[model samples]
Target: MIKNVIVGIDPGTTTAIAILDIEGKLLYLHSKRDWKREEIIKAILSFGRPIIIATDVNPPPKSVEKLASSFGCKIFYPEISFSVLEKQELVKAFVYKAKNEHEIDALAACVKAWKRYRSFFTRVSYLLSKKDASELFEEVIKKLLKEGKENVESIVEKMTRKREEPEERVEKPKEKGEKVLEEKEKKLEQAKKELEILTRVLSKRKAELLTYKRIKLSLEELEKCRKELEELKRANNILKRFERIRMKKFEPLVELESINSLELEKLDKLLGLENRVVYCNSLSNANVLNNFGIRALVTECEEEINVANLEFPVIKIEKEFIQDVDGVKCVKEDKLESLLAEVRKSGLIKWLENYRKRKENY
Candidate 1:
């Protein structure tokens, strides 16, 4: 049998649920400080099947929405639900002494839903039995809201017509000969029951066979994945043709770039510089660079600006600096060109190889 009731919820740190019947009578109103969603659902359903579910807030709380959806009922919402102050005022007439805020909010929502639909409920009750009317109310209001009164009247008229129609039937008298065949029919029924048992056993075996096939296919898929992994490793090995001699061949360039010294020497211990590279729009970033104990690679200095007593090597470069690309700073195309121009051929080749190794590592 379809039960008819309304449910309201206030979901929060303290969860509360309120239920009302078709006649606007309270069925249940309770709260839990620590609540579980499943228990809320269970409690709402335990009261009676919901005809309408409601909540007091706009953007109704997710837990409240979920409970309403699970109930599969018409949900009611006032154009704008009351504010906290308004709820206390509205609930005062019906509920004088509420235990807490959650209970008051919940009951207030239920009262609002009842007030909104009471007139409609009264007219529906007059049209049909209360049981029949409430069963149809969820459907009726949805259509009435979407279409209009005319559609709702048509639906009522159709239901009345179904109720008024008389059922008709005809029966043939049984013969004595039919009684004679009953014994044979009983034996045939017994044979059919045995056949059904065999059919069920066959179905179980077929399901087992399918399970075996799926297991075999899964094993094959895993084997294919292992082979693909091996192929990838071999591909990596094939591509690294110069891995054996890159370091030894990279030695001479170290000298080509060595004379580039005394960029800074015998300076003050600016304990504020070690470990991180800092970028600056201008040489003015020198103060920030000195304040923090980290590496500083300044970008806007066209000519070297050597400040006295500055211990850190705040190298100024004329090129774009790429952040953390394969473990090197300033590895962009322009930076590579500036490096080649400064260090000449041997160093350039070694730098190029290091960049390639970094790219491969990435």
Candidate 2:
């Protein structure tokens, strides 16, 4: 899914107002000299209400805030340094397709100025207080760039350099001026030795660099997994709390068969307002109850609570008045009671009981 974001900036003489999607896809580009803020804002809103509005202009004008507030969107103020190079790259790419030299020059100048500003900002930020990780990453990139440049230079030089091989001629032993074959052999051997040493050093360095990259990637993945695990643990704790509350509601229902008629009435009244109740005397009855909204209050017990209304299913008793069991839980009694009162007012419990009994054989 493409999430939407609208970026807006007050364009300077050389730069222009632009809007990009969340994926950094440019949607609208306009020169500041020709367009007003209202016009630009209107054009953007016409596409869709933006979830985020970004601006480099300081203390966003009241008019902009009012427009944003009307749409219930958030305004983001990203530092100006963030978008300068991005804008240049985008304009440069556009200008590359232009038909005229003037357009090309204009675009190139804009790109150059933006790049300089971006570099200055980056240098200042880096020098202010360099983060260990960021510094390491910068160092790695610089080393790689240096190595790449050196390799290209070396390849070019090799291709251009003239190579002279020894001329094949019959060896005529000269008395005084001829170099010995032993000297030539020694020179060749020395050259081979140096090449072998250089090759070995390069191979070792490459292996070490690969190992360092692997370790960095592994640490990043581990950190991501750790955060995910923490989120899961929090969710699990919430589920456990819910389970405990559910189990507690079941205890009264399980003891229903052992209690006297009066006690059963009290228990029924307590469980009814506190939770959705159900009665099941046999396995068939349990199945019938299960088909309804009720969940088992106690394992192997006939009684259950209605899952929808969180009330007990009605069991015919001598009393007509319904008692509230809101205070039965350990905590949040008031909140629970209030919720139950609201549910009762909605007539959901009565509807739930009738719906369940009619649908199921119980």
Task: Return the top candidate by lDDT.
Answer: 1
| Over 4 Å off, model 1 | 1-3, 130-151, 162-362
In candidate 1, the residue pairs with backbone N, CA or C atoms under 3 Å apart (3 or more residues apart, or in different chains) clash, namely: 272-293, 273-293, 274-293, 274-294, 276-295
Give the TM-scores of the predictions, in the order they appear.
0.41, 0.22
lDDT of 2 by residue, 1-362 (tens): 23343545444333244455433445655454555657767766655445444444346546546655654655544344334455456466665443443333333333333343344334433542333223232233233233444343333333223223355676567722346767777899999999999999999999999999999999999999998677677545544554565555422222234324454444343333134443223322333333334323222334443445323323322121222232222223343345446545555766787889999975
Q: All models: lDDT?
A: 0.62, 0.45
TM-score of 1: 0.41
Positional deviation of 28 in candidate 1, in angstroms?
A: 1.3
- Please provide, for model 1 over 143-189, each residue's C-alpha lDDT reduced to its tens digit, 9 standing for 90 to 100: 55445465445666666566567966433346445765787799899
Over all chains combined, what TM-score does candidate 2 have?
A: 0.22
